[model samples]
Target: MPSVEILSRIQFAFTIAFHYIYPPLSIGLGLCLVIMEGMYLRTGIKMYEDITRFWIKIFALIFGIGVATGIVMEFEFGTNWAVYSRYVGDIFGSALAAEGIFAFALESGFLGILLFGWNRVSKGVHFFSTIMVAMGSIFSALWIVIANSWQQTPTGYIIEGEGLEARAIITDFWEMVFNPSSVDRFSHVIIGSFLAGSFLVMSVAAWYIVKKRFVEPAKAMFKVGLCVATVAALAQLFTGHRSAHYVSEYQPAKLAAMEGHYDSSAVAAMYIVGWVDAKSGKTTGIKIPGGLSFLTHGSFNAPVTGLNAFPGTERPSAVNFVFQTYHIMISIGMFLIALTLTACFLLWKKKLFSQKWLMTIFIWAVLLPQIANQAGWYAAEVGRQPWVVYGLLRTSDALSKEVKAEQVVFSLVLFSLVYTLLLVLFLYLLNKKIVHGPEMTPNEEDDSDEFSKRNIKQLQA
Candidate 1:
């Protein structure tokens, strides 16, 4: 019971991490489905139609999981954080309701058509449904990002009460939606989602290539996945820079913790890699000279805030955790960029699918973006620390007082068991899909003998 706070936090984090895996995937797959179907419509390629069908199954699977796990998060608010829920109810209600009405409705309405209407509906109509579903997924992300960004940099709200009764009231809904960090963070997240989605596609395709299953289809799928991955990984670099600067302006302490800046300096160096020593309050590692200062303030000599600027209590509780996770995310992102570029070059050379070693690396590399995405979220949330709504609400004060430590501990255990089962099931099913590979039509099956010969030669070579 003494560890109730920790238990509750773990419970929420565990459920959220599991839930998070799917929505972003569904979002990415939603777009991928759009692209596949669009290509089929444009080129009248039967192969594209086959690929569309294949990925549609994967997308639907993740979408269902996302919904099932996501419901837990919704119920969690009232159960674990009633005080926080009541306070942000008005603001969250608006965003979530809009998502339900505008996003979910659009997605649900068209999902049926998208999954089932290939033969029944006109191609044009089905294409329209795919587009709608993609748009809905994006709009859903938009609202959720807006709500979270508001918490990061609260605006357009006023506190209407005191003590336990205090609540936020909207002043300008648009201002709330477009809060200070919203745009930058939103861009970062969607691209990260896309990056994860592309990784998933690439990993599966990579598996197929290495295992000598679904050769031509896997090659085609890998091409689309690589195209998406390369573009997204590159775009993230620029978007990440913009988001970092936004953090510098709005949440200096969080940024300070992320970069392991211990003391204010005009020529702050960004650690390319480092470890933080909490006892000594120092970070030691090889770092680019003046890189952090330049990125944060647009000049090498520009001053950057350090943890010392804020009281110790105001800073994130887990500096090492924040610092390590933030840097690990960056390291993975950079590695992915390099990997994608190299893959692009190999693709141009017409040797992408032939490279057994590269394909092997890619099969495992798909999990990198998921780790990076979760790390980014952990850094953002933990670095915000102490505060649940930035300057307005402390996290401790936001807890539901009526809930006891024993209850929270029990619920955490229950959630852990449930989530563990879900993870096992997801892995089993996903593995089955990958091993099964895409089913080729009779004509395509006949056509693959030549394709198989081509791959056989590559394997021999």
Candidate 2:
């Protein structure tokens, strides 16, 4: 029973949250494809080829859904956020156009060859196609993150005129692309995508192992997935630290809310586990005094700005939302790091495949990255509340004037129904694919022994 504006905002959030699920999957899967296909070429291993082919089906399915959902979001900008769109039209046009030219074209051009060209082209040619598709996915993330980070930081833009008629013009394209928050956020997103992809691959492989089906290829997938997960999880720690530093420097209000810093402090404490009492505007948790100071400023007693620096109206609208979601993301990230690193150690010890309990945990571990990704996104978007374009424009002023309450309500209901159906369809298709597993070519089956022979020492177990 919110007002029209609030309903519209909630509607958009719901649709976009649903849509956000696919891109990371596709992006992560793309990198896995590259790794698998590249290994096949280098080792001429049918096991690698099997992993590559099976995941291509998954990759294609995810990519299709991502494209579909992304299109819906684009239309929404014009429909629900018309005024905001006009204000940043030039900036969006440039970035989106670049995405199409650099990302979509490459992905689409090579995707067909990657998907359907196994029998038609040379192995080298097919591998090249996979490379392009992987690069394209990363490129897509780059431009999109750059655009979003611009909103968070409002860099390299100059506003002309005043009020409803004002527009922000890009002063320097490169500056805009590398805004204060862009590269840091971009790193976090890219690493998160890799983790997502790795976890998916790991989950399926783990399930196959537990079921005692597709043993060899599953081993191959699990090994490669472990590699990606371990490396990406470690990288995320670095990227996360840098991202937090940037947020602390440039978005103190958001940082304050994220850490639940209510009072001004020369040395800020980081909450390891915490919750906020929204009614009383008080934070409660066990925290390490000055832990945040060390993490963000490289000193235990460094001055860290707090929420009191911002006025009540300018503060984040949902402090609990930011606090809880950020902590969830951080906790999950640490868990992933520990999980992957443990798997890595066991793999080195050649005891990984025998660990049934661990495999069982990994079988359902795909959901962790999904949760972490959503939590991270929630922390980011909610922390930036009130501002649609940082300080340039408040979210209330960005709504389209022509859209009616009833129209938004109707659209929200319809979209919810359609999206629910779509979710069911997607899950059905994905389950069907997982249950069916990979189809090995006749040649791969014939060459299974040779392929298995080429699998390095670790996979020999």
Candidate 3:
């Protein structure tokens, strides 16, 4: 049996990983909703309104699931990680409070208007509501990322006690919010969310085209999705580079683990594909010599601090695991960039939709962004291993002292069963919606008062 600590960690990781799937979808879909509704208001085109209305239902479903799953982490924090919770309560409390006031309030307040206000409110008012909901989602991400980044590179707080009694007290709120890693990590996370949203759009649209249903609206949606995907995929390269630089500066040991670099005296080699023999400190792969050094320091000869620089107990234990996950994320990012860029080029040449092979690929490409997001998250969190809050606290010391291994195992099993059921239901509902297509009745497709009256009646029904 795993130790109580191990079981607890596994449980938390399982819950968080499962919960993570929906937020990116919600955030990304929020942006697409904004764009679609904006287009509706700008052009007075009923097709755009139909598209916006269709995705709003999907967005609401994702948001609900995301909220439901996210609440579990709060309980886990108190029940499984009591010590850690007490230690960082002040800091976390402030950030979460801000999320409620500035993020969730704005989002939830306007969400009803965005959803059911289609005929109840004017088009301009509805569009404004859509914009508010989108911005609110982004703000929610901003605060959450800030809190997590503080764990990575702690600042703007003072340690108030020692040993088990120690707590972090916020001294500079803005400084904490803008900690060294926060901006870069936030950008990376948000851009990744955009890719997820856009890819989902493309997948559904491509499916529609392939099935020869609602081809025109699907093309319009596909075009919007492709544009968003292209910009986001390209932006990811810059954000990833920026994040790497920050990691190299603030968390050298993690950076070393990510690349499987073990020789303190040598410039790091960046692997394209690799296997690490941690026992022997040998990493075998096709790699560019000094590639990591050059990327981090702009000099091929620059030496990077490596695993050897850290004490055995201080360095990440699962070095190879971090290396593989980090590499997988990088590889997926490159693939997305290539795929989107090529698709954009083909689109420019007017041959995009006809490319059945590429359309088929897009139909499944929704998984890539989700995979990359999960992989990147794992690499970052695991790479800092041994520490739940980086230099401030060790993960081993953060667990609730009285929690038994059996208790944790039981809860883990229960969570797994519930989450599996939730996932199945989500997929079933999503597939039903997709199959239904975005059908606009001839009466609802009109621009006159008749369209308004029909929409109101449909809403009442």
Candidate 4:
């Protein structure tokens, strides 16, 4: 039989990795829907309306998958991490409740209006629904980050008693919301969402450009995506910098592990690229000297703490892998921002679309931001070593006591197989929708007219 620790880690990793595949798309698509609807409103263009409707179909599909996978994660909290739940149930329960009440309800509610009511509502009203859907996504992210930030910084909670009877309770709601890491982390993540959505739009547009199809629709989508990508990319950089500084101050060990520095020193050099050797607690490969200090403290001579400062038991090895990976992710984000901005400038100067090479690069650039978003989340969650609830309980102590290693392994394998099938099905469906494109007849206006007639009859009653 596999060890209990191995089984638990496997289950957690499988569930989380599956859960992640959907939310970023949902969050990003929410903004894209808003932009599409707004463009239709401004220009009274039927093609824009058609494109919006087409993408919304895909968004709805993804949103449903996101909700389904997300629900599974909650159940695993009770099943796989029962002990952890019992310990921080009060804190997480509140944050989760808020997510349901504030984010999920708003999202699902307006989603009905945005999707089905498209035909039944007026232009202005339909536009408002799209805005609400976007707001809902942002609200959803806020509560989730609040919960995760608590895990990282762990504020406004008190631990009472000891052993199996121990519990962590919330003392202040606002304090929890405005936790030290919450704001920067939230901004960085939300901007990443924007980047994801913008690039997806750009990708589809690029496909159209290559095929020389849907010229007007593709151009409009590309322009909107370019603007969003540029802004989000810039904001992400700034927020990432701020978050790194926050990590330096509040979670010095994580900061140290990320840089792979074994000893504390002033003017620490950041390794822009490297392979970390866990046994020696050092990194090898390419290095950028003095960059770490400058990035963390905005000074070349600022003292940066190292891994040796922490107790042997407290140091996390695999967590450092996540840290290093996050830097690579950020570098990818920076490169995309520069490349997209340059493309945008060229497009504005009427030189971009004509260049086949540039168009080819833009077509394939969608994957970069997606990688960065996933990597950033990995860094945040993995960096909080030992503690599942940050100072309240260690992960080793928070696993299910009643569960057997064999049972957990069985379930882990089952989950992986099932999730793999579901992923394949989802991808197939998504590709079908993309390849079919928007239908020409029975457009958004026609749908709206039919809805108005039905509504008038109801009003007469």
lDDT of 4: 0.79
lDDT of 3 at 372: 96
TM-score per model over all chains: 0.96, 0.96, 0.96, 0.92
- The parts of candidate 2 lying over 4 Å away from their true place are 443-461
Instruction: Give the lDDT of residue 182 in candidate 2.
Output: 93
What's the lDDT of the predicted structure labeled candidate 3? 0.91
In order of lDDT, best first, we have 3, 2, 1, 4
For model 2, residues 104-178, the per-residue Cα lDDT tens digits are 899999999998998899998998999999999999999999899999998888898788888889999988888
The prediction achieving the highest lDDT against the true structure is 3
Measured with C-alpha atoms, the lDDT of residue 446 in candidate 4 is 48
lDDT value, residue 184 of candidate 4: 90
Residue 427 displacement in candidate 3 (angstroms): 0.3
lDDT of each: 0.86, 0.87, 0.91, 0.79
What is candidate 1's CA lDDT for residue 369? 91
Candidate 1 root-mean-square deviation in Å: 2.9
Please report how far candidate 1 places residue 249 from its true position, in Å: 0.5
lDDT of 3 by residue, 113-158 (tens): 9889978998889889999999999999999999999999999999
Q: Candidate 1, which ten residues in sequence have the lowest lDDT sum?
A: 447-456
Q: Write the per-residue lDDT of candidate 1 for residues 280-327, one digit (tens) a residue.
A: 888999998788988877788877889888888788979999999999
**Which portions of model 3 miss their true places by more than 4 Å?**
443-461
**Residue 395 error, candidate 4, Å:** 1.1
